[model samples]
Target: MRVLTILLCLLLTGTPARAVQPDEVLPDAALEQRARDISAELRCLVCQNESIDDSDAPLARDLRLLVRERLVAGDGDREVTDFIVARYGEFVLLRPVFGLHTALLWLGPVIVLAFGAVALVRGARRRRQEAGTPALTPEEKARLDAILGQD
Candidate 1:
């Protein structure tokens, strides 16, 4: 019953556990909100699949603090994001910007889809041709006649 109740409560609350400690929160609400927004855009290096705001890893905590520090330093959202990207490279961004460096990353899925579609069309055509009729050679025709006792 306890476990069931606990699961029920967890299902009702969908937000993931945040890594931010109370001490890391700024007194300024607006600055804290900006820091949170920035943190949400950052990928946690220790947990590549999670945003720094959602990850509970130590590196995620550090990243959250760094975002808060940048906000406190009066840096705008873009400036803070660029500063982190400059330091960590583009991998730190959860949503990578499209550019020459990331062109393959952006286009690879479309290219694969196109190739898959072409292969499906070719396969369907081959199956259709095979299903249509048997193109028998002269020797095969004689063999068929022998098998049918018509030779």
Candidate 2:
């Protein structure tokens, strides 16, 4: 039973199935690796969340082929990536480049965090102030005492 469980775990956690076909694999090992690396960084437009390497979508296949084609054409990694970015826009990149255009994407989290921290600090200060002092003024307290005495 333990051996069966171990086998199941190994099968489940083993290398994930890739979408790359045997025909799609380049003969040149180095170029094929580069193509694969590039494919892994490209987002599949159809899948939206999956990389081209993992997605079975036709667009992902096209992108994979395009990457291989670019490699075969002697384009460097950066050049191939630039070409894809130009053709498909930066949204196709799994990891987007930080620049003026993508500034919000890169900085929005930090900005939100900073704003939340400021709000938290302000909230803590307000809570401390409230805890330190009486909620009512001296006159109000005197009025309350008089009312209670009358009652």
lDDT of candidate 1 over 1-151, digit per residue (tens):
9999999998998776788889989999989988998999999999899999889899889888888888888899999999999989999999999999999999999999999999999999999999998899999999999999996
Model 2 backbone overlap count: 0
Highest lDDT model number: 2
RMSD in Å for all candidates: 4.5, 5.3
Please give the lDDT score for candidate 1: 0.92
Instruction: Residues 1-151, candidate 2: write the lDDT tens digits.
Output: 9999999999989998799998999999999999999999999999989899999988899999999999999999999999999999999999998999989999999999999999999999999998896788988988998989953
> CA lDDT of each candidate?
0.92, 0.94
Error of 2 at 85 (Å): 1.2
TM-score of each: 0.82, 0.82
User: What's the lDDT for residue 1 in model 2?
Assistant: 100
